[model samples]
Target: MEGIDAQRLEVKKERAPKLPVHIAKEVTKGRLLKHVEISEKSVLPTALDMYREKVDENLKGEIKTHDTSKLRHAEVVEKNVLPTSVDIAREKVPTLIVNFDTEKLKHVDPVVKIALPSVNDVVREQEEFKAGANEKGGMIHN
Candidate 1:
């Protein structure tokens, strides 16, 4: 043992009662009898699951009772269904039609045509105005 090198020593591992290759492979892959978490809640059936028909009947009864109560409350407050004074006033107030036809607008009167003074004409007028201002001791507008 002292003379044998640890790295050179061979260790043999064996499984007693040899398993079939397919089953061994499945066991190795964790696909055979896999582990599962079991709880009481998960194992037991819920009220709805165990008594679906009874639960459905109970739910329908509750819904009918709720609807009847709502109807009775609505009947008590039925007068509020009528429009208020403000609502009546708003309805009476006129609303102008805002929709317009582009075709109708195209056929409308042409925009007022005004001739704009040419650039040269405007320059000439400004030159004459400046000369007049100079002649008037720069008090033309004053």
Candidate 2:
């Protein structure tokens, strides 16, 4: 029995359709405006205006159920802790990375130590005893 052999086929390249010279020249020239003019005549402008109006209408009274006290609490939390948390996190990454550049490390180490608060450090204490009497009806012992 003789075996049949299949030959590989070569792919042919097709030429792209050419536009007319005049039309091509007009396209290359300023006939097509670079910046689109968005006017009432454009459907895009009308659609955009309608979308904005719908959004504004839907947003109305959305905050009516919101608790103002929660906002105050959030503000307090942010004021007391957010800045410190961010500063600590920022300082922590470099310390953990271990491959800091020499000069950058020198600068960072001191700043990190100073910027971050120690857990065991005492916050404040009384300076000295006051000899004067208390004004708010409390007994003053010298």
Q: Indicate which candidate wins on TM-score.
A: 1
lDDT digits (tens) for residues 1-142 of candidate 2: 1222222211111243568888767766975737787767644668889999988877775666666776644344445545687788898997877966666544444444456645544332111222233444556553
Q: After superposition, how far is residue 47 of candidate 1 from its true place, in Å?
A: 99
Per-residue lDDT of 13-82 in model 1, one digit per residue for the tens? 2425678998878877885676889876546777778699788889999887784544543345445588
Q: Could you tell me how far off, in angstroms, the CA of residue 142 lies in candidate 2 after the best superposition?
A: 99
Cα error, residue 9 of model 2, in Å, equals 95
Which candidate gets the maximum lDDT versus the true structure?
1
Model 1 is weakest, by summed lDDT over 10 consecutive residues, at: 6-15
Which stretches of model 1 miss by more than 4 angstroms?
Answer: 1-111, 139-142
> Model 2, stretches more than 4 Å misplaced?
1-45, 69-142
Instruction: Tell me the TM-score of model 2.
Output: 0.18
